[model samples]
Target: MEQVVNMGFISIIPSLLAIALAFATRNTVVSLGFACILGTFLAGQGIMGFPTLIKTSLGTTSFAWVMLLNTFIAILVAFFQKTGAIQGFSQYIQNKNLSRRAVQLLAWLLGMFVYFSDSFSPLFVGTTMRSISDKARVSREKLSYIADSGAAPVSVLVPITGWAAYLSGLAVGIGAIVTQEDAMKLFIKAVPFNFYALITVIFVGLISGGIIKDFGPMKKAEDRAIKEGKVLRDGADPLIGKELTEMEAYPGIQQRVFLNFILPVIMIMTIAIGTYIKLKSAKTMEAFLFVMIFMGISMFIQGIPFKEIMHTMTDGVKGAVPAIMILALAYSINSLSKQMGTANYIISISEGFLSPQLLPAIIFLIASVMAFATGTSWGTFAICMPIALPLAFSFTGGEATTLVVACFAAVAGGGVFGDHCSPLSDTTILASTGSAADHIDHVKTQLPYALICGGMALAAYLIIGFTSI
Candidate 1:
């Protein structure tokens, strides 16, 4: 055990070094790839040669799950887009004669709902809502902020998502550390305490309602937009100007666009409710089937030819390939960390910090840090479960709920926190890309909101930890 742990810790050195290098150089893809390679090398060690390591590193269940999830999401997105659903949604928002605040609120709700449907929350929500947000004259920063706020955080809150299921499975594997059931229960409790996610929702409400004025760079951008009667920045809504041109030349496609907009949503909601009530144990496959069915229904309703739907599905899957590659690489790195005992090393470090009054806070802090570092809350939970769960059992004196909630909250909140900021994180990239906002701009503008939420979450953890009742 000691040897495995030592080797595991040693193996992480390359990844750590690579991340530092990436940050220093500001090369996102290179930095991520280097980290992934380092992880694979450390995992392979001597048991497998470089070729085997490379193959297995990219061939894990985590990688497979990404492919499956992305394929489904891409298909659904494409179906909606090709059928003109997105245009329809945008039209409805514009035609409603609603206030900008109302549009922002609706954007927030859409963001939350999209988070539940796919891990690609940023792309799903941003792509669908960009047109609407633009029409409302909401700044791209605010749109990205709303999308980022709800994306991963909401996923962490839900138990039936890819994020939740993945983390729960990880929790179950750590010898007697934590059970899948216990891990999930903890996640549920932590949802309320997740200050970052909660604060994000609040921030949107406040900002949209004019209770909070834009400030700093965001303020400048908004001012420029209002004064110039247009966005002054080059990075403003990458998709907007381009799509407007296309829609103008092809006005016929815009005619029944609203129907396309409503179809995918109705389908996804029905599936979400069905999965929640009937197939409680549904996995990625169940979700895929549900989404596919809805797309089919959409085709029939929209009078889209079957061949056209199939073609769109193919195109959607193609678009998802890049994200799939990134996800696969990420999963491979995580799996390698597990096999190399890096996870156990993490657990070992966390074990010494355990205490009764501080246990929940510790869980929150530790899980958040680990999730942020690893870019996977589920990975963080998997690593901590073996360590924290058993400690919780031994130290809680019987307040399992407290321990469970703390652990769950830490993992869920931390995962969202990490994914929110990580340069290499899929959601971060997708949000920017989908919104046609520069990736760095999106990251920079939206980070404060995430940090604010993180602060609130920390306070909530302390409150939950200290105040009995």
Candidate 2:
């Protein structure tokens, strides 16, 4: 066991400061940076600890993967813009005169189909649907909400996903979860209990299908888009730079639907899904690299000059710079979170009032707070599972009962709720970038709906807890 650092109440200051600053300034990078500095100083590393923190935090293989992924996806988004694929596709959809409801539902379905990778889903769906959604007068806020809804929430609920395997792997050796097979059974059983993910997906479907009328800030955004035909509100700073979004198609180049957009996306889906099935890990970044190459070559053959292709690629990289910087600092803050024992601090505060009837509810809330603070659901699982599962066992007399699975579901759903709301989360950032929505605007609009689902999930957990007792 790693020795626990006892900073007591002070350990939570960094996360609170980072989140508060992010909301207040609407500038994620600066907020994360300042919070990181504060966290380093408090960790007894003094002023110099900041650099060491960055060096270690951004140095990981995972961080490198995310940075590269963002760059590659940005390049593809730029290529799509430059080739006029999105615009051309929107034109076709316009000719079809698809209703706003149809367009929103289409975006939701597209997001659902791209379930192989959470990172790939939002970017592809956002880039594909942004023009179409705008044409239908769908708010950028609403589009982003659909894109964000489909990523982690959808990914975590599917039983065959990497999410399921990783979560199952986490339960090993706890009570009756003695092996991978044992853990898998328990995880599968807990899927129906993942209320937040289930309800979130359902909510998207209802709203997109126009079954549920828009409410809260989203209703305001939708009203503006409908009444004023402004997909984005006035003065909104979209996460994606206009360099990509506003990049005009090269002159005199024919925009072939198959070559410019559809084929390259097909290639991405094939490569990503094919590899996940055969190799057990999705080669998502490699898929992006290959598609980008295919797209560049295809565009070169389509009469777009070699120089223009190169220029668009450069612009693509530039457009992703802001998101990349935010991600880098987000990683740093998460690292700082670990070193300062933020999750541990939250857990310590909540672990005292335990009973069988309340275990599921409290565990869910703790996992929610932990993931919300750290902005990573997988990280939340890694920390919460070992502690939470064992504690549940103590109450259940070492049995993997319905109460145990309920606890499992609580952790999974709770992590997702927090992940959805946090600005520092990668999926939320990716959603904003994908839909070309303002970063803070996406959060402001999506939080009310996420909280609704979360509240319902909490009520369900409490009901289950009381009945199981």
Most accurate candidate by TM-score: 2
lDDT of 1 at 109: 80
Tens-place lDDT per residue, model 1, 213-254, is: 777666765665566644427633342223222322122344
TM values, all candidates:
0.78, 0.96
Best by lDDT: 2
Error at 87, model 1, angstroms? 1.5
lDDT scores of the candidates, listed in order: 0.61, 0.89
Tens-digit lDDT track of model 2 for 27-110? 877889999998888889997999999999999998999899999999998898788887788788889989999999999999
Instruction: Give residue 32's error in model 1 in angstroms.
Output: 1.6
